[model samples]
Structure formats: structure tokens, C-alpha cells
Target chain A: MFYFILDILGTIAFAISGVMVAMDKKLDVFGVFIVAFVTAVGGGTLRDVLIGQTPLFWLKDLTYIVTIIGAVIVAVVFRSRMSYFKRSLLLFDTLGIGLYTLVGVEKGLAVGLSPIMCVALGTITACFGGVTRDILCNEIPVIFRREIYATACILGGFGFFILRQLPLEETYSYATAILIIIVIRLLAVKFKLALPNIYKST
Target chain B: MFYFILDILGTIAFAISGVMVAMDKKLDVFGVFIVAFVTAVGGGTLRDVLIGQTPLFWLKDLTYIVTIIGAVIVAVVFRSRMSYFKRSLLLFDTLGIGLYTLVGVEKGLAVGLSPIMCVALGTITACFGGVTRDILCNEIPVIFRREIYATACILGGFGFFILRQLPLEETYSYATAILIIIVIRLLAVKFKLALPNIYKST
Candidate 1:
């Protein structure tokens, strides 16, 4: 139940972010909705697909669809006021990524993937939506370029595996994983930490 | 057996295209490989994921990987000669898309998707690799902006459905569908046909 609520919140947060990007790009209404939908569901969809989960998580449940629509509506309606709520939005986005990382890791474990693959899955699930959004918006993916976002997810994924090996209950391990992601992301942003650029100019 | 060969050829073609794009972007060797891999496999990966296939096609088979690597190696070695081979490359790419479109549609049908959904799947399979490659190269997807590429696939998908409805052998239908895609794409390129922009500036 808790995870379900978190998933919905994450969807809304991601959708809102997508809306902001689409607005920035001056996309038409259809384009805005497409971007918002892709941003909200793209990562999870990819994760589910990799795990051989058919029909996708969102397609099976209409609630996610409704939630994204609600988010887009709110974004369009409160466009002018969004800047004032930036901090809160960031918090929501952070929470979303943390929750998604854990969910993705759990799904990977359920599918009996290797530990490394599970961690990769978790990071992909937590970051690929933003990647898709940025790509659609015609920009380099922020996670790949500017921020320590995916790194945080990878750390959290490792934490999840490590915690699972301990004597603690499964729920505790999951909580620890989520907490690790949230803390790392928060610290990275607060400190303005970034990964080294791999691109070399000729 | 025929499809398998076609799939390998298509992978080589797409990977070559990816290498070309990466070279144009002045990406390093690792970057070039990454782009090549994504361009060769991205569309089929998306299709597989949507249909709930696990571990991905390339993950199961090393042949695809080797093919991509070979393509990248050849591209790097013959970088200066690529412009002269543009016409042949176009033909190969067109063949790749046609074959991929049929494969995607067949997979979707086998998984019991609606015909329209299968057609959509076919178009995605035929085009998304290039979309992913372009995005990774930090460019807007040519298909979405200025090409009749995806349109040819859609038309071919429709042709597949129509041909299947006939009393001819299944192989004939499949061959006809692929031919339709190739012919349409070749014509579109030759005539410089493009979709009108849907993005309207306010």
C-alpha cells in the first residue's frame, strides 16, 4: 500500500517535470501530453519489459494513466505558480526517484537477475524517464551529463543488496535502500556534485 | 533461416549508420560503440520489452554483438570512404527497416496484440533505433521532424495486414509487405517527401 502510494506520487512528479519541459519547448498540446506520459511511465515500462513482464505495469492499471492526466492538468493550470513551488517539486522528484529505485531493484530480484543487472535495472528505472524526456526535448540527458542522479541510484542498489545479506527483515532492507538513494541525491544536489565528462573535443 | 540472415544484415546496416552518426559527432571510440549498439538494437529491444520478452534479444545472442562490433570496426577503418558509399548504405538501411517492420509485426501478432497495435509496434521497431541513436547523438529524431521514414513503415504495416487477408501463402504476404516498405521508403527518399510540421508557434 505504501509503495502503491509512492508510485502514484512518483508518476505525478515525473509527469509534472515532463510538462515543464514540454512547456519550455513550446510543444503543442498533443506533444505535451505525449512527453508527459512518456516521462511518467517510460522508465518503469523499460524495467518491466527487461524483466519480461508483459502488457506493462501502466497498461494493466488505469490508475497510473489517470494520475498522469491529473498531473498534466495541474501543471497546465498552475504554470505561473510552479516557480514558487520549485523546492517542493524537487522534494517530490527526489522521493519519486528513491521509491522507483527500490521498486526496480525489487522487480529485478524477483526476476532472478544477477546482482549487478539488478542494480543496473534500478538505476535505469530511476533515471530513464528523465532521459527520455530530455531526448524528446532535444537535449543531452541530464543524468548522463550534469548530475550525480544515476550514481545515487547505483549506490542505493548496492545498499539494497548489502542490506539484504544482513539479518534484518526484508522491509528494513528496502527502507534502507530508499533512504540511501534519497540521502545521496539530496547531498549531491546540495553540494552541486557532478560526474566527470566523458566527451572529449577533437 | 531467411529471417535470421536478414536480422543480422539489418543489425549491421543500423550499426553502420550509428557509427556514421557518432563519427559525425566526433565521439570517442567508446561513445561510437555505444551509439552503434543502441542504433542496431534499440527498436527491437523496445518491441521485445513491450511484448514482455526478457533479457533482451542481443543479451541472448552474441552474434548481434559481433555484427555490431564488426560494423563499427569497418566504419572506423573506412571513415573517409563513407560518403562514396552513401547510395548503397541507403539501400541497406531501407532493407533493414522493411525486414524489421515485418519482424516486429509478427512478434506482436504472435503475442496477440490488436492489428492496429501490431502495426504501431512494427513502425516502432523499424524506426526507434534511429530515434535512439539520434537522441544519443543529441539531435532531434529525423523521423519525427523531417522524414517519411516512419510513414513508409506504417504503410507497409497496413500492407502486411492487407496481404495477410489474401489467400496467398504466408511467405508471399510477408515478402510483399517488406517489398512495399522498401519501395515506399525508396520513393519517399528519391522524391524528398516529408511530413508537415505539427508544432505550431503561438
Candidate 2:
């Protein structure tokens, strides 16, 4: 139940971000729809493919597709009121990052991947879709450049692992993971935090 | 030995196609290199993942990376001369489609996939990267709108399947596949052929 709610929230966040990015490119409705679909579903699709899941995730869940369409409709209809939504984007995005991290971690565990592999998968699930979206939009991914994006995911996965090891219930562990990710992301944004780039001028 | 030669030729064709697409985007030298790398190897990577091949194609053969880098250098140094090269892009692209189709079919057959799935994989191998490139560049996929792109690949795959049942050797079978794809594509271009859109006006 928690996972389902978080998943939808994450989808909404990614959809809005995608719509915003398409707007930057001055794309039309179809273009916006494509971007939104890609942003919301791209990471999970990649993860599923890597895990050799057949038919892919969206094929299994109609709700995800419907949510993205809903997001695009909402964005388009509320274009005049977009400015008011700007301040809320960060909060929504943080919520998304946390939820998505948990999803990746849980999926990785379900597949019996090692803790290290699970963490990597969690990070990939949280960040790679945005990376793909930015790459397709002809820009470097913001997660790669700023805001401690993958780091937040890693911490969230660790939180899940630690909480699971304790005497806490499954819901408590899951909530802790999401909270850890969301709080870390929010703080990073509030404090203007970033990871050091691996590539530097020689 | 013929498959080896055809593979190299196909890589070169793919590399050139990637460079030409990058040129269309007016990307800088590094941008062209990255785009070339992605374009030439993206489909193969996806294939490997779907087939449960670990570590991926380019990761196994570093030669693919070297080939793309070499193509990028040739493209950058001859940017002005690349205009003349555009005339050959279609031919190279067609050759690439044919060769990749053969590779996809052979790989799928090796993995014991159904003939229908093999044909689909062949089409994916031939056109998925270009679709990806167009999507990233904020345009509708050329494969989606263009005249008979995947159709040519399907035809080539069918040619391979038929030739395999004949008295011909594997090399001839492969050559027949390539010839079928190239001829069909060239004729399609010459005749201005197209598929009818399924979505009619509302």
C-alpha cells in the first residue's frame, strides 16, 4: 500500500518535471506527452530490462500509463498557474526521489541481488530516468551535476537495510527509507549541496 | 570469415550513420563523439540485455569503442566535406540496417527465440538507436515517420530465413539478406514509398 502510493507520487513528480523540460524546448502536446512518459517510466523500464523482466513494467501496470497521461493533462490545463507550482516542485521531486529509491531497493532485494548491487540498482532507479531524459533533451543530467541525487538514493537504500535489520515492522523500515531520502534531498537543495564531479580539468 | 568482415563493415556503416546524425545536430567534437558512441552501440546493448548477455556488447569488444572514436575524428576533421558525405549516408545506413538485421537474427536464433521474435529483434537492432537519437534530439523518430525503415529490416530477416532453407551456404544467405534490404530501401527511396498512417483524422 505504501509502495503503491509512493510510486504514484514519484510518477507525478517525474511527469511534471518532464513537462517542464519539454516546455523549455518549446515542444507541442505530443512532444510533451512523449517526454512525460519517458521521464516517468524510463528508469523502471531500464531496470526491468537489466533484470530480464519480460514485457516490461508499463506493460504490466496500466496505472503508471494513466498517471502520466493525467499528469500531462494537469500540466497543460494549468499552464497559466505554473508559476505558483514552481515552489512546490522541489518538495514533490524530493518525495519522488525517496519513493523511487525504495522501489528500486525493494525490487533489487526481491531479485536476490547483493546489497552492493541493490544500492546501485536503487541509485539507477532513482536517477537514470532523469539522466536519460536530460540526455534526450540534449542537456547533461542535473543528477549527474548537482543536488546529491544518487547520494540521496544510496542513503535511502542504506536506511532501508538498517531499519530492516532492526526489530521494526516492514512499514516502519519502508517509511524510514523514504524519509531518509526525502530529508536528505530537501536538505541538499536547501543548503545548495552537490557532489564533486569525477571528471575535472587535467 | 565473411561474418567477421560483414560485422566490421556493419560497424563502420553504423559509425558513419552516427556521425552524420551528430553532424545534423551541429554538435561539438566531444558531443559528436558521445552521440556516435551511443548511436553505434545502443541497439546492440539493448539486444544484449534482452538476451540476458552479461556486461553488454561494447564492453566485450573494445574495438567498437575505437571504431566510433575513429569515426568521430573523421567526421570532425572533415566537417565541410561531410556535406558531400551526406549523399552516401542513406546507402551506408541501408547497409547497416541489413547487416544489423542479420546479426540480430543470428543472435536470436542462437538464443532459441521464435522466428517472429527474431524478426522483431532484427528490426530493433537495425533502427532502435536511430529512434533513440531522434527522441533525444527532440524530434519524432525517423523510423516512426519514414518510409519502410523497419519494413526493410523485416524483409531482410525474411530473406535470411528463406535463404537458410536453401542449398546456399551461410555466407550467401547473409549476403542475400543484405542485398534484399539494400535493394528494397533504395527502391523505396526512389519510388517515394510510405506506410499509411493508422490514425485517421478525428
Candidate 3:
């Protein structure tokens, strides 16, 4: 039940963020909805597809689809107040990546992937929605270029594994791992940390 | 046997195109290989996933992976004379889309999708590897912005259905569909056919 609520909130956050990005592109109404839909579901869809999970998560459960639509509509309707919710939105987005990371890691474990691959899958689930959004909007993905987003997920994944080796319960390890990701991301943004410039000075 | 040959040829062409694009960006060796691999197999991978085909086409068959590696190596080795092979490359790429479009359509049909959705799937297969390539390379996909690529696949899909209704053999319809896509694409390029400018003057 807790995970389910977080998933819905994450879906809503992703959908709203997607709307914000699409609006920046001045896309048509249909274009905006499509972008929002893809943004909210693209990561999970890709993860499911990669693992051979057929019918897809969203297709099986209408919750994600309905949540995204509602979120998009609300965001679009309250466009003028977006800036006021920016911080809140950021919080929700951070929570999203945190929960999504665990969801992916668990899925990878179910498939019996190596620990490293599981971490990679977790990061993909957390970050690749934004990757898809950037691709659709014709820009380098923020994570690829500068953000500490995937790095936070990776570190959290390591934490998850480390905690699993301890005497802690699985729930404790899971929640602690999520908290680690959230803290890392929040602190990274708060301190304005970024990846080193990969391209040499022109 | 014929389909297998066409599939290999299509894989080679797509891989070569990926290498060419990655080369233009001056990416590193690993990056170039990744782009090429994705370009060669990404479409079919996506098609299989959507239809619930597990293990992916490339995973099930080592042929595509081997073929893409070979194609990329050759393209990179002969990079200095790339312009000289531009026309031959173009022809090969056209053949690729023609074949890939049918491949996707057949997959969709196998899963009992309607003709229209199957056409959409076919176009996705024919064109989205380039989309993935462009996204990775940090640019708008050429097809989404400027090419007649997906349009050719779509028109050919219509031709495929029409040919099927003529009491022709399945082989004849299939061959005719591929031919339609190739001919339309060649003509479009030869005549500089393009979707009308969607973006107005800034």
C-alpha cells in the first residue's frame, strides 16, 4: 500500500514535469499530452520491455495512466502558479526517483541479474524518463550532461546492497536506501554539485 | 531464406548509417560502436517488446550483433572515402527501411493488431532506430523534423494492404510492399519531397 501510493505520486510528479517541459517547447495540446504520457511511463515501460514483461505495467494497471492524465490537466490548468509549486514539485520528483529506483532494483533481482546490473536497472528506471523527454525535445539528457541524478541512484543502490548484508529487515533496508537517494539528490541540488565537464575546452 | 538475407542486409545498412552519424559527431570508439549497435537492433528490439516477444530478436540470434559489429568496423575503417559511397549507402538504407517496415508489420499482425496499428508499428520499426540514434547524439530526429522516411513506410503499408486484397499470393504482396517503400523513398529523395514546413518563421 505504501509503495503503491508512492508510485502514484511519482507518476503524478513525472507527468507534471513532462507538461512543464512540453509547454516550454510550445507543443500542441496533443503533443503535450503525448509527451506527458511518455515521460510518466517511459522508464517503466522500457524496463518492463527489457525484462520481457509483456502487456506493460501501465497497460495492466490503469492507475498510472489515469494519474498522469489528471496531473497533466491540473498542471496545464494552473500554469500561472507553476513557479510557486516549483520547490514542491522538486521534492515530489526527488521522491519519485527514489521510489522508482527501488522498484527497478527489485525487478532486476526478480530476474536474477548481477548486483551491478541491478543498480544499472534502478538508475535507468529513475533517470531514463527524463532521458526520453530530452530526446523528444531535442537536447542532451540532463543526466548525461551534468546532473548528479543517476549518480545518486547508483550510490543508493550500493547502499541498498550494503544494508541487505546487515541484520536489518528488508523494509528497513528498502526505506533507508530510498532515503539515501533522496538525501543525495537534495544535497546535490542544494550545493549545486555537478559532474565534471566531459568535453575538453574548445 | 530470402527474408533472412534481407534482414541481414538491413542490419548492415542501419549499422553503417549509425557509424556515419556517430562519426560526424567525432565520438569515441566505444560511443560509435554503441550508436551503431543501437541503430542496428534498437527498432527490432522495441518491436518485439511491444508485442511481448521476449529475449529480443537480437538476443535470440547472434547474427545481428555480429553483422552490426562487422558493418561498423568497415564503415569506420573506410571513413576517409565515405562520401564516395554515399549513393550506395543511401540505396542500402532505403532497402533497410523497406524490409524493416514489413518485419515490424508482420510482428504486429502475429499478435493480432489491426492494420493501422500494425502500420504504425511498421513505421516505428523502419524509422525509430534513427530516432534513438539522434536522441543519443543530442539532436532532433531527422525523420521527425525533415525527412520523408516514415511517410514512405506509411504509404507502403497502404500499398501492402491493397496488394493483399487483390487475391495475390502472400509472397507477391510482401514483395510488392517492400518495393513500394523503396521506390517511394528513392523518388522522394530524387524529387526532394518533404513534409511541408511545420514550424513557421520565428
Q: Estimate each model's TM-score.
A: 0.63, 0.59, 0.61
Give chain A TM for each model in order. 0.96, 0.93, 0.97
Tell me the alpha-carbon RMSD of every candidate.
7.0, 7.9, 6.9
lDDT of 1 by residue, A1-202 (tens): 9888888888989998998887777665545765788898889888876676886766445687779888988888788788887888888888899999888888888888999999999888989999989888898777877898999899999999999999999999998899999999999999999888876784
Best by TM-score: 1
Number of clashing pairs per prediction, in order: 0, 1, 0
Fraction of true contacts retained by every candidate, in order, equals 0.29, 0.06, 0.28
- Evaluated against the true structure, the overall lDDT of model 1 is 0.85
- Candidate 1 lDDT, tens digit per residue, B1-202? 9888888888888999999899889999999999999999999988877777878888999999999999999989998999898898898899999999999899888877767668768987989899899888887666655677888888899998998898999999999999999999999899987754432222
Instruction: Grade the docking of candidate 2.
Output: incorrect
Candidate 3 lDDT at B5 equals 86
Tens-place lDDT digits, model 3, residues A96-202:
99999999999999999998989988988988898888779876777898888999999999899999999989999999999999999999999999988766776
lDDT of 2 at A24: 71
Error of 2 at B38 (Å): 6.8
Q: By summed lDDT, which 10 consecutive residues of candidate 1 chain B come out lowest?
A: B193-202
lDDT of 2 by residue, B140-172 (tens): 555545467778888889878888899988988
Every model's DockQ, to 2 decimals?
0.17, 0.08, 0.16
